[model samples]
Target: MGNNHGSLKKEATQPQHSTTNNSKDEKKIDSRTEQSGKTLVDIPDDLMRKIIPYLGLIDRSNLAVTCRRFYEAEAKAGNSKNSEIWDSVGIDEKGKKVSMYKCFFEDVDDESGRYSIMRTKRMILSLKKTTPATTNAVIQRIFRATTATKMEKLEAAMQLNDCHSESQSEED
Candidate 1:
């Protein structure tokens, strides 16, 4: 009877250990995948933090697809508290100013807008120096951005016009 109890305990503990190990292995495999279709393990968090602010949204999205650590670092660096990183990309402001500045941009997720404006300006500057072959691609990207902004503005105007018409109809 004693020997049977000991064997049962060993059987229970061994499966638990294996299941835990299997879960950890799955997480490791998932986190090691890279956006560039390669497997990379254990990129230092400090290096990711340092490099993250310099990347545009597209670059960050590409990098985050590769590793869990990079994705966390990107999320941390996106907010107002990371103004030093934003300043490095040419949107100059102290970290303390972020909260107050954000209040004025209440209509949208202002962090993206600030980052986009800075990146677009930098891209425009870069376009000035690129060769003719690269110019077309750059121009297309800029045009697409401008077109999107215009469409947003047009949509807003349409919404406002609809509101006025509806209110006038209600009065009638």
Candidate 2:
């Protein structure tokens, strides 16, 4: 019975399995993620854009340098809202769909993200601050120069020449 007691105790206790391999793999993944940067890079651009607005400029700039994907995504997600930018310019109708346009950051249009007036405007404002001021007669001059307003004028002219077209079109 004394000899059987040792075997019974051994059988009753569960064997402790070593986690050496798993620990090594986990450590590797942790180090790789830290070295490569945050795993947030894997998120989709649209969703990322919503999250982007909540981050301050400093944080955005930091994340921007993380990777090429983040840079492009950050640029697209900057202060601009596609509809607001488009509507403000009066050129919303010029582009078939703003979402389809090429993003400024990416040279390759094949997979480039959406264009952003907010990003463009931000750049313009930064430049404006550094340059000498040129006092224009009125802000109206600036408004007319916008691409959207220009396009709207061009469309009006073309429709104006089309006398046979319905007069109802002019009301728009």
Candidate 3:
């Protein structure tokens, strides 16, 4: 009976020891995984900035907010040169003209309007100089016509009359 009791005590103690060893092993593995994750920190700022232009507007915005370092890096890299970045400036898909400084200025308050206008004008000037003359003429005509007829609904309607509207009422 004494021998049996001693053997039982040994078996229970051995299992407890093994369990403690297993827990330690698990902790070591967890720590190693964490350290491996930290290894990604070695990526350079320039590479990260280069990658920012490919990201969507929301992703870029969130990433910019992540740290001031990232913001400066992105700005230095000219990530704002990416066309998608203009979405934050409130130029929607319909108004995405390289020449439309007004769209950019309209989105910001008066305090920032001058800067936005200057930046947009610079971007427009940087566009390819060889753009077709016909395209320029058409755009200029549209701009002049729109500005001249802005407050006159009938004139605006007359200007658009040549444009085909898909609505049945307009067709009639």
> If scored against the real structure, what TM-score would every candidate get?
0.28, 0.28, 0.30
Please report, as a residue range, the 10-residue window in candidate 1 with the lowest summed lDDT: 1-10
lDDT of 1 by residue, 38-93 (tens): 43324455655666767755566676555444455565553332233333222322
RMSD of each: 19.3, 21.8, 23.9
lDDT of 3 by residue, 45-81 (tens): 7676677677654466566555555554444444443
Kindly report which residue stretches of model 2 are placed more than 4 angstroms away from their true locations once superposed: 1-38, 80-172
In model 3, the runs with Cα more than 4 Å from the true position are 1-35, 39-41, 78-172
Model 2 TM-score on a 0 to 1 scale:
0.28
Best by lDDT: 1
Q: How far is candidate 1 from the true structure (C-alpha RMSD, Å)?
A: 19.3
C-alpha positional error of residue 136 in candidate 3 after TM-score superposition, expressed in Å: 13
